[model samples]
Target: MRIGELARRSGVSERSLRYYETQGLLQSERTSGGHRHYAESAVDRVIRIQTLYAAGLNSKKIAKLLPCMRDADGRPNEIATPTLVNELTTERDRIDRMITDLLRSRDVLDEVIDTAADGATTDPASLARRR
Candidate 1:
């Protein structure tokens, strides 16, 4: 398919697809007139790229990570290693910490919201006091 079809199917923008190509996260062949052409599998590839990005992996990491992923046959590929596992573990740990911090922040915000809702105190000092 062409870039426009891939963009429409994947729900990603053409500019983003071009950027993904530049980042080596996606691939396309050139037509005789220099237009880009992608394989039918490009749709799935683009969706996987979006999934990894949503998981907090950057383009560079996804570039490396994409090759080792399981194919449609559901078998492991030949590219996984202990080093990569360690790096992925570290990324997971970072995400865990981020989640922890966000939950804590949300708890504080909840307290503030509740206090305000109760009309307990208009003063900043009263808001600072936790029940």
Candidate 2:
């Protein structure tokens, strides 16, 4: 399909698709007239790329992970390397920490909301005293 069709199907912008190509996360062929053409499988590839980006992986890391992923099932292939595994583990750990921090922040916000709902003092010093 063409870039427009890919972008529409994958819910990603054409510029993003081009950027993915430049980042080595996606592939396309040029026609005799220099128009880019992509295989039907490129749709799946774009979806996978979007998934990785949504998970907070940078383009470079996504590029590394893409080659090892099975397009059909989106599972890792048997080409695991120690370096790749380590990097992925580290990225997972960072995301875990971010989740933990976000949860803690959410808890604090919930407490504040509850306090406000109770008609508690909005003044910081008075609220601290009431607490």
Which ten-residue region of model 2 has the weakest summed lDDT? 117-126
As a whole number from 0 to 100, the lDDT of residue 28 in candidate 2 is 94
Model 2: per-residue Cα lDDT over 1-131, one tens digit each: 88999899989999999999899888899989887789998988898888888889999899888888886666666696789999999999999999999999999999999988675655677678876
lDDT of 2: 0.87
List of clashing residue pairs for candidate 1 = none
Q: Which pairs clash (backbone N, Cα, C closer than 3 Å) in model 2?
A: none
Candidate 1 structure quality by residue, lDDT tens digits, 1-131: 88999999999999999999999988999999998999988898899999989879998888878878986567655677788778888889999999999999999999999987777567676678854
TM-scores for candidates 1 onward, in order: 0.80, 0.82
Per-model C-alpha RMSD: 5.1, 4.9
Candidate with the greatest TM-score versus the true structure: 2
In TM-score terms, candidate 2 sits at: 0.82
lDDT for 111 in candidate 1 is 94
Residue 78 of model 1 has an lDDT of 61
How many clashes does the backbone of model 1 have?
0
Candidate 1, which ten residues in sequence have the lowest lDDT sum? Answer: 71-80
